[model samples]
Target chain A: MLKAFASYMTYEFIGLDQGSRIGDVLNFFIYDTIKIFLLLTVIIHAVSIIRSYFPPEKTRKILAHKREFIGNILAALLGVVTPFCSCSAVPLFIGFVEAGVPLGVTFSFLISSPMVNEVAVVLLWGLFGWKIAAIYMVTGLLVAVLAGFVIGKLKLEKWVEEYVYQIKTGQGQQVLTQTFRQRLQYARWNTADILKRIWLYVVLAIGLGGFIHGYVPQDFLVRYAGNGNPFAVPMAVALGVPLYSNAAGVIPIVYALMEKGLNTGTVLAFMMAVTALSLPEMIILRKVLKIPLLIVFAGIMTVTITAVGYLFNAIL
Target chain B: MEIKVLGPGCANCHTMEQLAKTAVAALGIEARVEKISDIQEIMKYTMSTPGLVVNGKLKHAGKPLPSIEKVKAMIKEEA
Candidate 1:
């Protein structure tokens, strides 16, 4: 009787050990969340400081003289460095228009600013490595330039608010009075402010990501998102539209989804969609643009990026 | 050193103020922290807020106050 009881006890202990080990593996995801959040915070703050030195007014002048194809290239390059957020869009737009920057060139800057922010670049690099980061940067720039050229050709000048054109043309050349020291001070403050607003979003998204990292049923996500699924890319893009998050906040989730066996193309499409088509940004845009223009902009971005995402996944 | 939390008195702004106080206390720093709620005044230094100004230099903006270590580093760098 004693020998039988001993054997039973050993079996139960082994089972519990295996279960607890799995639990430990799951718990590691929490640490990953913390690490990612802290890293992103630092990177974003650094970018914010850089953006402070080059005010939007300065960018306006650069785009003005270089209008057309060259201007589009310059604007895309600037877009890679500038860290403008959704709120800055209208003011920047007005500034560019006031400076007589060609519509397509200015549009390129606007599209690139929010879609490929510094924080997104840093986060993508951290999550996926330099190759994916480079791909995103190149692909993102192409979309902005192409979209701007197309819209410019369409002659969307009538869409501009009259007040925007009347608001003192060439305000870009006005010398900012703030001292170098003061500018640095402003940059630091902006960095912290942006970080505070988005930190919660980052944490919430990462927490969801952590949970996904731990226990997403891989077979299910894969069956839908995986290879040769004709609808997968568009479906992913559509799914991403309503959701709003900065790239810094979404890349971790993307990584988690990928780990769960989601296709790279689908994940990329989702990332671009969420960043570019945020509902909050759309609501904000409504204050500035007519509904038709807003829909067209969003629709173009969604279709273009979905195609890019699929192409990337198939190629690499 | 004087620390100011600049914002439009939103919920997040208030939370930032409290967090700044807590972080300052945690570090046992001898500093006066004030919340600047006026939009006009906040715009004087930054278009983005809640801005964190330590010793008249903006330490952070568009984000909450950082952890205790960051605060201490700012103090050290400024000092």
Candidate 2:
């Protein structure tokens, strides 16, 4: 449908030759921009409404006093519905510990919340196919669960800041109940707000994709980072870690790289590293977690994500 | 009464601040609504941004932000 509109705009409206490179690039850009923006708006609004049901306070209550494996899984899944900001890490950490939620379970929520975000899922589905998107989500959850579980077993609670355990959060405020109308209003506001923040990144990503589609040689990236290269996954993850960007911001670059023939697994790992293991999140987490614990968390994430990348490369 | 909305100035923090202000006005109450963006100040009150502090007490923190009516009620309780 969008392609037809793009063709009409280029050929019938502007009278450009259908076979021209510029026309093809223009058509691709227009179609992608419209489709992605539409997808983002509808999906983000729906997710926000669902999110209104799973506030951090409620999530903490659900995970509080839960067992190991079950808690990890629940926390990982809830991380998707829960609203997360790195800025809230300290409060969230302190709140969870004070509420008697297991440290590992809280870590699961923290890891998955940023990694398996709605924007990342929707963008992957829109740009790639459903299969790749599903794989990314499942793998992201696995990473969170396994990493959190391992950290739990290590008994790293002692490494947390002393004040976190010492502080008492006296029956923290109750979750705000919302009517359907209010939920709709909040969702609308949230969708508009998110779109405003990410619109530029979307345009830039599609524009870059269009450029790659028009001019970049198909074999350029394949020659360097294709399936045969053993180090490609780790290299991608290493490069992705220091660069701080949300999924939306990185999708354009991912699109460009994939079009240039980078393997799917390498690109996926890169996206995970960028969103999940960002330096800023680490700096924020450092305030609550001692140095040794912080290093272990980063180390475990790096190893787990790298393994996921390699697994995908081997299978797909 | 003194009211503080704590956050790092993210969108939700701004919304919470606006809701607090509107609630204060709707109740015809004399109160100052302040936004605390500094991380240290926010930590002292609560770890959550978009926290609501009324007269030195932490009233609400974190998501599922309250409606204007709820905010008003919280203020009423404090007052």
Candidate 3:
């Protein structure tokens, strides 16, 4: 449906030759912009409503006192639905520890919250197919779960900043109860807010994709980061660590890279590294995690994400 | 009356601070609204960012931030 509309607009309305490169690029750009924005709005609204049910307070209660592996899995899954912001990282970390939620479980939540977010999922689904999106989600969860469990087994709890454990988050925290109408309103506002923030990135991504599709040679990226290159995955991961961006913010670049013949695994790894292993996040987490633990966390994430990238490249 | 909005100065915290000020004005109450961005001070009250403390009582905390009307009601309750 979108393709037909885009075609109509590019060829009939704009009076461009149907076979022209510009016409094809314009069609792709229009179709993708409409489809992606629509998908983002609908998915974000739905996810927001679902999120309204799983606030951090409730999540902390759920993860508290759970066993190690089970807690890790649950925390990783809960990370998907819970609303997380870096600003709240300190309090959430302290609150979880104080609530008796295990350190590893909290790490699981922390890792997956930013990595496997709704924005990334929707963008992946919109740009690639559902299979790629599903794969990204599963791999992301596995990385979080395994990394957290490893951290747990290593007995790194002592490495956390002592102040995090010392701080007693006062009891009897007030829970805001909202009616169904309020939830809907909140969802609407959240959708609008997210869209407003990400629209520019989406346009830039699609525009880049369109430009690549129209003007850039198909084999341009293949020459450097193609499947034959063994170092592509690691190189991508290494490059992604220094760059900080949300999932949505990085999708356009990912889309362009993929269009230029970058393998699925390398691109996905790049996306994960960019979103999950950012230096700024490490600095923020420093308030709760000690230097050693932070370094270990970064090491584990890089290795896991790099491995996932290579695995996808080999198989897909 | 004193209202303190607790956060690390994130956007939501700012919004909550604005809402508190607007609520104070709407109710025509003589209330002082303050934003506490210091992590230590915020942690002392609640672990959640964008927390609202009305006259030293924790009123609300965390996301899906309350609307202006709800903020007003919370302040009125404290009053």
On lDDT, the candidate that comes out on top is: 3
Model 2 lDDT tens row, A217-242: 89888888886789999999999888
Where model 2 places Cα greater than 4 Å from the true spot, the runs are B8-29, B34-47, B53-79
lDDT of 2 by residue, B1-79 (tens): 9999998766889999999999998999999999998655675665557789898888776665767887898899989
Over 4 Å off in model 3, which ranges? B11-15, B38-46, B55-60, B63-79
Ordered list by lDDT, greatest first: 3, 2, 1
DockQ order, best first, reads 3, 2, 1
Report how far residue A188 has shifted in candidate 2, in Å: 0.4
- Supply the global lDDT for candidate 2: 0.86
Q: Against the correct fold, how does model 2 do in TM-score?
A: 0.89
Interface RMSD of 1: 7.0
User: Who is ahead in DockQ, 1 or 3?
Assistant: 3
Off by over 4 Å in 1: A1-27, A30-38, A169-188, A201-211, A249-252, B1-79
- Residue B4, model 3: lDDT of 95
In Å, what is the interface RMSD of model 3? 2.8
Location of the lowest summed lDDT over 10 successive residues in candidate 1 chain A: A168-177
Q: Write the per-residue lDDT of candidate 3 for residues A1-316, one digit (tens) a residue.
A: 8889999999999999988888888988999889999999899999999998888889999999999999999999999999888878988888788899998899999999999988999889988878999999999999899999888888998899888777665644566687999789879988887887899998998899889888989999899889779999999999998898999899889999988989989999999999998877788889888899999999988998999999998888
Per-residue lDDT tens digits for candidate 1, residues A1-316, read 4334333343454333434534434344444445556666676656655665565656776788675877887888788666455654545565567667888798788778778777677666655667777888888887788777777777877676555565553352233346767556655666677666666756665556556655667675777667757788888888888888777667666877776777776787788888777777677556556677777778778778888888887898
**What local lDDT score does residue A273 receive in model 1, on the 0 to 100 scale?**
84
